[model samples]
Every structure is written in structure tokens, then in C-alpha cells.
Target: MNKLEIHSPNSPILLTASLHVDEARKAIASLVSDLLTESQSRNEAGSVELVTLDQAINRILAEDLLSPIDVPAADNSAMDGFAFNGDCLSSKDDIVTLKVVGTAYAGKPYEGSIGKTECIKIMTGALMPNNCDTVIPQEFTESSDSSSVTFKQNQVKRGENQRLRGEDLQSGKAAISAGRLLRPSDLGLAASLGIATLKVHRKLKVAILSSGDELRPLGQALDAGGIYDSNRHSLTGLLNRLNLEIIDCGIVRDDPASLKSAFLEAASLADVLISSGGVSVGEADFTKQIMQELGDVGFWKIAMRPGRPMAFGVLKPADPKNPDRKSLFFGLPGNPVAVMVTFYQFVRSALLQLNGANQTEPPLIQAIAQTPIRKKPGRTEFQRAILERGPDGRPTVRLTGSQGAGILRSMSEANCFVILHHDQGNIAAGDWVDVALFDGLL
Candidate 1:
């Protein structure tokens, strides 16, 4: 396997005769790690702000939040039952009767303490009285009147159905840590701890654009050899799902001047500039030229199928006066499926890190291949596949029609990516392969 060389800003560019030349192909793991490291170095740590619990979902936590008070501030009942002293029950297997002193509803606790053979009718979430240690569910008792109840002895263990103070969360403990993406349950947890507002990192700003003379915007009439730009739409949707602020710069012509203008403008306004097409070694590919002139960019032939040509670096201001101002750049492939695959695999985690999120790569599960797959051993392959359960309840996967990079329908029809590792060759029907589900971002 060829190792990906990490080049400095002044490193010399390696040129090959063909775009598919196999020399110095970068491993996907190394490329992703480098990208993340670079992104972290450039990350500004985002601004902090206070947002109410209702508005905190999907926001990244900016600080470690220690709970000021314990959850369930007082000991409470976990079920609607009769709260009593368990020691009063007889050790023999016979009926144990108790006199109900009072009824304790939720939020309205019975103030008086219970004596031996005395109990209180408690509702769920009701605070337990001082002497009560166990609760017998109402269904287990045969109570004809509100005065007393009778149940079989040894029916419930001591301290059963009772919620202790600080059981869910203790005081002065970290309720939520920094860099955590707040979920609905997280909001509820915060609310339970009386945390009305939270400090969270500001949303990331991403500027996206597309390049190619043959590409036109949606709803525009296409001339000969021209196609609607689906990449921009797809990229926009993917970025929007991340809850980041997106600046769509639309399409730039393949001319050098037009490409240069777009890159400069994007760098000035956004934290990350993402462009599709124009990274390949075609005659009209001026994006590479302009990117290199403005900043330190590396064009790489990743050892992967579907998406091979990629560019990653930081774009600085072309003018020397603003040398410190820069934006991260990711140049993706032109094909629709390739763009999505590369973005999900490489760009997504980097952006999450930039957004102050605790980034974790999605795990790939082992699934049985339902059909024979022809593959080469040198390059990694990401084939669109439909995953389903087999007769034995094991996960099975099959390719989604054609595996062409340009085939957008393959991505639309598939639920996961059947990942063939770089060293793996061909696969039989029953072979176990790794698959990444599209449920997270898709």
C-alpha cells in the first residue's frame, strides 16, 4: 500500500501523466485523520451563548455543566402504590393488613409519618413519607375502602418501587460535558436538573459552490452537452442537516478568472469552502490552479473507488495585506454519487469537529453479501447497497443496480454503503463484508 505523504505549505507538487496513476495513493484513514487534525488547528472554538432548553437541541455544549441540585430532589415513589414500613409485615406466608392514614398524590405529599401496620396511598411521583421504605402496588392489595388495605405477606421486597434522591443524577456532578451535541433527552436531563439555559457553541458557517461549464442551475434550460447541477442541491441538503449556516454561492463557470473570484469570495465569508467538480486533471479544471495560487492546497488521488480525485487545504486571502485570514477548502469529485460519498466519509467529521462537536466515526457492521462482487485489491470500493435481514435474521446486503459514480439513482435507492477494503479482492455470496448505514446523515 502506498503511504500518503504529509506535505508542508512549500512542498513540491507531484504530477503524473494520467489522472488514475496509482503512484502515492493516500489511504482513507490517513487522509481523514490529517483532515481532522488540520481542521482542529484551524478551529476557532466557536462563540459561546446561552440558549433555553427548548432551543438547545442539536447544539454543541460549550462548557462542562455541573448540576446544582440532585434529580428527584427528594425520595419519591416510582409507582402508584401503598407506601408503608416493610418491617411491619409478618415473616409468615399470610395476609398482612395495614390501616391507611392518608392519601399522597403527586406534588402533594402526606406530611405525617407512618407507624407500624400503617401506610399511605401514594401516587406515582409522590414524595415518600419519612418512615415509608417500601411500596406495594395497588393491584396487589385487596382494599374495599379507603381506611385500610390487605395484601399477601412477602409480596414486595424491602425498599421496592422507591426512587432515591440523586438516583438519576447527583449534585455537583457533570450533567453534560463540553463538546457534546445536545439531543432531546439531553434537554430533558438539563430540565430535570433545573437548568433553564445552556452555553453552546455557535453554528458553523459553510460556503458551498459548484464549477463546470457543462453544468447549469436547476430550472434553467440546458443546451447541448449541458446538465442540471445536482451536486449543489445535494450538498446543500447535506450541509443543512448539520444545522450549520450555509452560504450557497451557486455555480461558477470553468474559466480561470471566474474560478478565482469564487474562491476568494468564499474564503472571505465562510469558515469552510466546499466546491464540487474542477479537481480532476481536465483541460477546463481551473479550480486547482486558482486554489494553489491563493493558498497551500494538495491534490490527491485517494485509494478509493467512486471518489478518487480530491483537494484539501487552507485558502488564504490572495492579497498579502490579509495573510492571516483563511478558510478550509474541500474540492470534491464531479459525479453525484462520488460527491456524496466523499462528503460523508471525509468532510462530515471534519465539519463536526469544527462545530465543536465530540466527533465519533459511525461504525460499520458486518453483513453477508447476497451476490458475488467483483473487486480489485489495490483500491477501496464503496458500492451502494440495499441491506435487509436474511431468513436467519442476519443482515444481508446486495448492490443497488449499477455501481457507477455518475449513477445518482444508485445512491437514492440504497440504504448503506458496502465497503470493500483496499486489500480485499473478490467476494462470494456468503462472504461477510462491512457496511455503513445511511440513516445518520441521509
Candidate 2:
């Protein structure tokens, strides 16, 4: 299936077509599946490249990474303790005294094994000696001289504090799987496995363009109807987080010629093209008209608040020689908050899949509502909210100042989105609600 593979432990998604029967709008999940299906059908998988461990962040793994050797290499001490044979363990009433043979540091091991009633003073991470199978922490042992150490017989169990070989990872085993989005922790793991270079997917090329005559670039004065082009800058930041190669195509006028030229140019240079504005119903239709001329496209009336109109399709380059060359297209609404909402809900996950990442869902947490929220039943609402600890130290969420589509400040002041589902209605104070956070607590 072309699903995004969302994972949830508690409540399952119950959104159905009957929720928006009056408007006949499509569901958000339906759109995501279609986009994924289109992406898979358009291209054979992207080629892989070899890169140093430091350069692999945010890149997708093309193959499984296997460990060449067992982790730890041998049995080792998990803490600073006295290592001795576990056969000496007895009743809690008995105290066992053993001769201290020698000391062992992290990288140094005792030359010879110890006999019964003998133990070695071992530091953390030091290899356990051949005759030792248990450890008694130094703090639990009574004061001991250079020759001997004393501890209660019931202090530790057999094999306690001894790290077994291959316990973390075995030799020739898959340490990291294919299609993983490499994080800093993943790099550390690869380094621990002695892997210096990784096979990863090449960077995806993305082109961003803004449409509308009223859109003004930086350093330009805005006229009565003109506004600064904030969407491009926001899109750039979002795409940068994924490490994609971004092309900033300046704003295009509403005319057919300009929109057509901009679309064709971006398609030629990028694997994916994202255009904001001019996609909604009754808006010139220049974007859709030009897109259809180049390739196939569809305009959707999604049943969601803040963002209702969306467009998705594939566009081919103007080049006659490479007729099969195409680029995936995402058309976002013009309203500032709507653009961000739709991007997070749809475009981000779709791009990750196209870049060869394993499909995964964004982290979500349920928080108690601090105040009443006015909402209708048919449409899904992505209401911006502030998530913080309440007086009792539990998470509590409250909506931002305004929930309008044009309120950019609402998105700015909020740290999360309180998702009121399609079939959901008004939320009262103290009611639990599902929240999608802006960033995870690392």
C-alpha cells in the first residue's frame, strides 16, 4: 500500500468520508497515500553514494550496516568492583574474605587467573579474568588492605556486573538497517562499529517558487497590496533541515507566460518543485493550466480547516531530448499559516519517502486542554497551542491568541498543534487532546 505507516499505541484513526459528507472533501491521509504512490511510480530508486561518517547526517542509508567484530570484544567489568568466582556466594549471615591478587585497569588485564578465595580489584570496563564470573561493588565491600578484600556473601549474584561478549551487537550482524534517516546517534553507532564511511542516498534537489504579483522580495518596499515573501524563506529553512539541495526561484507574476516559464525552469533543475499560492479554487488556474500542459496534475479540496485547497502532480521539463525526465510537484495555499500547516501535514513526509527514508510518523503526545476551544465537526483543525507544564507538573495545552488562517503570529507563538480530528467537535477545559509538537524533546 502507499500508506505513510503511522504508528500509534492508543487511539486509532477514525476519520471517515461521512465526517465531511456535506462538503465532499478528501481526507488528509488519502492525499498522502496518493502522493507516495505517484512518487514510487515516477522514478526508479535514487542512486547511492559513499560518504564519510561526519557527512552522512540527514541522509538515508542505502544498505544494511553490519558489525565486523563483537561489541566489547570480550567479557568486561561494568563497574569498579572486586571480580571473583560466584561459587563463593552463601547465606547473608556469612562474610567472605578473599586475597586481592592484583588490580586491573580499563585497558590492562591481570596476567594470571586467581584461585578459589582470591579476587582481582577491577576498574570499570576492565576485562573480567578467566576464573571470575561475579563482581561485588567497592562501596559494598568492607575496608580492605592491599592483600585482602571483604564483603557479605549475599552482596552479588552469579555473573553480576560482568558484561558478556556480543551482548550489545554480534560480529557480522546488521547494526543499522537500510532506509534509515541518519541522525547524530546513528553516526556514533557506526563509529563504535569501526565504520568510517557509509553508503547513503544522494541529496535530493528541491526547487521552491512563489507565485503572485503582490509577492515582494527582501529589501523591496511593499505596495498597498504587496507583501514580503516569507513563504520562500520558511520553505528554505524547512527543506534545509532535510539536507536537500534547494533552488530559490524568485516570485513569478500571475500571468500565464511567467508561471509557465518558472514551472518549466524549476522542473528542469530539481527532482521536486514546491510552489506556494495560486493553487486555491477560483484563483487564476494559471498554475494548474501550465502544469497540465507539461504533465499530469490534480487540484484537491481537502476537508480541513486553515487549508482547504491543494494541488499535486508531476511535471516534465521542456527539454525534448530527455522526454522521460519529470519532477514531483506540491502546490501549497497562499495564506501564511495554511502553507505551514499543509507542509507539515503532507509535504514533509512525502519528501522523506521520495528521498528513500523508511516511512515513519511524527511524534505525538496527548495533553489536557487548559481552556475551552470552539471547533466544528466536519473539518480537521490544526490549532496552534502553547504546551507547558501545569501546576501539577503534567502537560497542559492552550490555544494561541487567534486561530485564523492569516494569523502568522499564532504559528510563531505556539510550540505545538492541537489536532482536532475530522469527526471531533468542541473541546472543553480539562479534556485530553492529541498534540503534535513543533520539535521533540531531545
lDDT of all predictions:
0.81, 0.80
TM-score of each: 0.86, 0.89
Q: Encode model 1's per-residue lDDT on 208-265: one tens digit a residue.
A: 9998889988789989999999998999888876778899999999888898888888
Off by over 4 Å in 1: 1-4, 7-46, 89-95, 139-147, 150-154, 283-286, 318-322, 389-394
10 residues in a row with least lDDT, candidate 2 = 3-12
For each of the candidates, the C-alpha root-mean-square deviation to the true structure, in angstroms, is 4.2, 5.3
**Worst ten-residue run, lDDT, model 1?**
17-26
